[model samples]
Target: MRTASWGRQAGGYAAVVTVAETAGLTWEKDDRPLRGVPGAVRRDHGDLVKELRDLVKRVGVQLGTLTRALEGGFTVDTVHPYGWWRAELAGHPLARAVVRRLIWEIEVTPGQWRPVLPEAEHLPDAPDDALVRLWHPIRSDPGTVRAWRDLLTERRIQQAFREIYLLTPAEEDTRVHSNRFGHLVHHRRMFALFRARGWASGLLGPWDGSDEDEAVRTLAAGAWQVRFFHARADWAGDHELATTGQVRFARRLEGTWREVPLAEVPPLVFSEAMRDVDLFVGVTSIAADPDWTDRGPERAYWELAGFAELTESAEARREALQRILPRLEIANRCSLDGRFVVVRGDLATYKIHIGSADILMEPDNAYLCIVPSRRKSDGQVFLPFEDDRLSLILSKAFLLASDTKITDESILTRIKRGA
Candidate 1:
């Protein structure tokens, strides 16, 4: 079993709310800044606004820690005492709000866990000494998990983080990735992504730092480690380009860390760690750059990377699309083919790779490059969850579906021209 952590250290809601109310300020969900203040008020209350902003920022940062804790399996320290839970989690305003956003499990008997929705009933309604902990999809059966996903959808509940629909493919245990990421990614972007995902690595260079480095992240309270290998590509003699290699897992035996075959790692720990790596690769990979649709000499590399088999992240997107497509206004125009979302557009029939979000138009497999942007797509549909790539894919589909209506020259030029 993976080690357990309970997120009690999080500065609960903190004093930000109290200060906001004192200052006559308002806030939106996710601690977004106080919005919609009048012009005169904005000018006169500048100090108050700045102070509120700083406080909100602090709260967001603290909540970020709690989010990571939950991802790593945060349980209450009071394990088996229902009254203890009431005092620690249910009694407080902030804690109660946090508890409502997540699923909790009650262990009715030893070795048997039943996931309960916090909003469904009086959560952990068993005897005072009943065992309870935060529920994770990795700890539940697939059918049950799927049912929860459906419940979230039907109820239109937005999760603090992905709970259901999180991909934990048990079959992918033995076959880890090798020579995974390709192309030139600026070290700034790469390093920032690594830091954001809680991964660390040494410098990459010819001198001082080694030409190769292994970016590693410890998971499961130091029970496991994931190492992602990469070397300087030196394609243009620039150390900025990284040629990535194998992603391996290891176990911490006694006090020494030793590399272990992925099969030896527990499934939950493996899945949790892999999700971090997948997110890093998904966001930072050159395949994400829509402008790189036509790199003459590297066309093959680009195509292979873009059209490759779906990772767990892409699998989750596929699962979401299965539910979302029917609700889309362009429902008749879109359908999911293997590894691609096929959309029939006025300009051409297009295939968008679900994994890399690369697009290929039908006439001659022409490139239809649509970069990710904050611009809203031509629809007002409720999404059960949020994924940047999913939004980008849907936005691109909407654009292609209404190709003739697209007035933007950049997009029209790409649609009319071929690579």
Candidate 2:
């Protein structure tokens, strides 16, 4: 099975919140910081592709600058923030191309579809379309994509194009809500992946709304859909924002910004429950639960409830801190245990080893990983834990013996070598 990841949720949230907060701060200083940037870019498939093209071009400009730096051996390392050049280049043009090619293989290519057989070993040779999709981005050029234009349907074309567009920001398998057309329309956010054409691949969100429910009905049938949290019955508004990750909201109070913990939010405001769950579950619960819109004093009541959840005040906050301590401690690390690899990037990383499974025709499909993270900590690197690792699942990592240059193999090798 393809991997699922949530690493982008929190980082995306942080980016937005930081922008909001920074905008607010600049407003206080009488200077506009986000004036030129769109409030937040959102789009459907077509518009998303356009936005992606624009983003890629911009990124290309940056990559050009980094290309200059690399010639001088300016490797991006944790010890030096200056090496952001590499990080900036991580999920760029080439990466985006890989994503699109994979999506075409998983979603559009015909006859290449392989069931998630319980005991199949190694994947069959993908259809010609799948291979073309894989190489398209790497070899993308007017002539290259044009010669194969007839090979992809308009939808697949757009999808693959968007996949390439998405690659730049999809480091560690953190796909974005904006990248997926209708994701933010349903849950606050979501991530998706696909491997072929004429096949179905995408993720389900945590919320259930009319529009989202409708899309899911259309997409879920005869395809793969994994709903992380069941939508609550009462939620009235789409809490797509909740899926952004370890979300915390703050409102200006008496000229000061106060952190509003999720748990402290009025339970009645949530159409569902939010206490005692992992990152995705708790946040998605709040977003899908339908108690936020009742007619009442929004601020006063919320503040009172927030204080109430703090009955033990400091102790309760401390416990809440303890609950998130592991996540916080390893927020940007990746770990490995036996056959599984768990990643904890800005989003979540959860992977399982299929080595023992009989679904592969070769050893290449032995491992399936979600989002992965690479961090330099005291000169030692970490992989996922055997169990007890809780993060969003993103990306799939397959192993190949040395000498393979396929994207998956290259990525794994780079990760291993870096670690």
Candidate 3:
């Protein structure tokens, strides 16, 4: 890190810690006082293990924070009067880890982007006034996106977060309010997830206007914003209910914010905004609850959500499957349908929904129940990115593809019962 940033990071951390004990701030790689401990003191196994585990967890959290910032292009100061992107970084080891691995795109002119490798010489070559933002996949054509995906795959560079194949909803989407994410979500967990993603929201209660909350984030610098709305449902003790509302976009116009039509929102901003909402909903929704299907009225909601149209992440899964299926052992038995990966096994020809990871077998689209496993990958295949649902989909495809060798009684009965 440069000398200037080094001082700022240290002094800032000290002040924040001095002010509030509850403030959620963490130490940097070099700033941890634990580094000053003597080698002999650190030799104690239990103490060292506990401290190392805590440090790792904190650092992981900090890295996740920076990854989201970089992915969302928050580092690009789009509001700069000179229109020069300020992508400078220092102080945080987490920042160094992420920016080093990323391949950026510099906008030399309007609608023209040149891929910028992480080299000092190439970075400085761009003119001072050129706008620089993270090269979002949605900004490019399908061919370009596909090429980049292949490039990353060939390099085997693991991204700190989903990058080239990041879930980007269709550019032409015009939904003013999305009920697609609507359902009961755990109240505390929902807000916590939103906060981690840099969304600012308010409390929702039974009162008039206070009954709804919108988690919002600025996109495309300060020019645009996306709001994910939710309404208070009911709460009892620690269990509270909230239903998702509308996803609306707005623009900063003439010193005041004005609502913008979804079609008019810039493609990159729209994609980024929708992606955040998807993450929030995907993690906190009751539909992701494995037992939600066993509930009463909520069962209908689970069914709808589980069978809902392809999410951006699921869309990524579909593309990955497209590239992976032809190379699999059961290539002939598997085919990528629009939203379902059709896998034919001797016991049953199954259809796995790319969006929800739900399964259906042949003779009828009979739902073949299988939940996502705790282990994301079985370590059998090379995955260019991390996605649990994608892993589940692939695992099921492989298992069913060689169905005659299956020994799991539960799976066998499900196949035989044909439900």
* Model 3 lDDT per residue over 1-419, tens place: 11112112322232112111011222333454333334443354345435544655675666676666666563243322112343444223345455545656676678776765442223446566765555555556788778766766655444423433232253236345445556677667888988777789986665678778788887776888788888776542344668886788889999788887777776557666776777777767776655554555556777778777876677777777776677666789999888889998988899888876778888787777665344344444656676777777887788788878878788789888893
Sort order, TM-score high to low: 1, 3, 2
Superior by lDDT: candidate 1 or candidate 2: 1
As for lDDT, the candidate ahead, 1 or 3, is: 1
What TM-score would each prediction reach against the true structure? 0.81, 0.19, 0.70
- Candidate 3: RMSD to truth: 8.6
Maximum-lDDT candidate: 1
The lDDT-based order of candidates, best leading, equals 1, 3, 2
For residue 91, model 1's alpha carbon misses the true position, in angstroms, by 4.5
Best by TM-score: 1
**lDDT tens digits, residues 72-191, model 1?**
663222243666776776554444554555677777888787777765566556777777777767766788777887776666564533432232344254354433433445455777
- Cα error of candidate 1 at position 283, Å: 1.1
Total clashes for model 1: 0
Worst 10 contiguous positions by lDDT, candidate 2: 19-28
Return whichever of 1 and 2 wins on TM-score.
1
What is the Cα-based TM-score of model 2? 0.19
How does candidate 3 fare on TM-score?
Answer: 0.70
lDDT of 2 by residue, 1-419 (tens): 12111111211221111110011111111222343223343322345435444654664555445433332121111111212312332223333222222222122344342221111123334332332212223224455543343333321221212111212233224321111111111233322211111112244444344222211111111122122222222333343332222212233457554544333332221111111112233223222222343433332332223212111112222222233324434433434433333333221233332121111112233222223342233312122211112222211222221113335664455444433
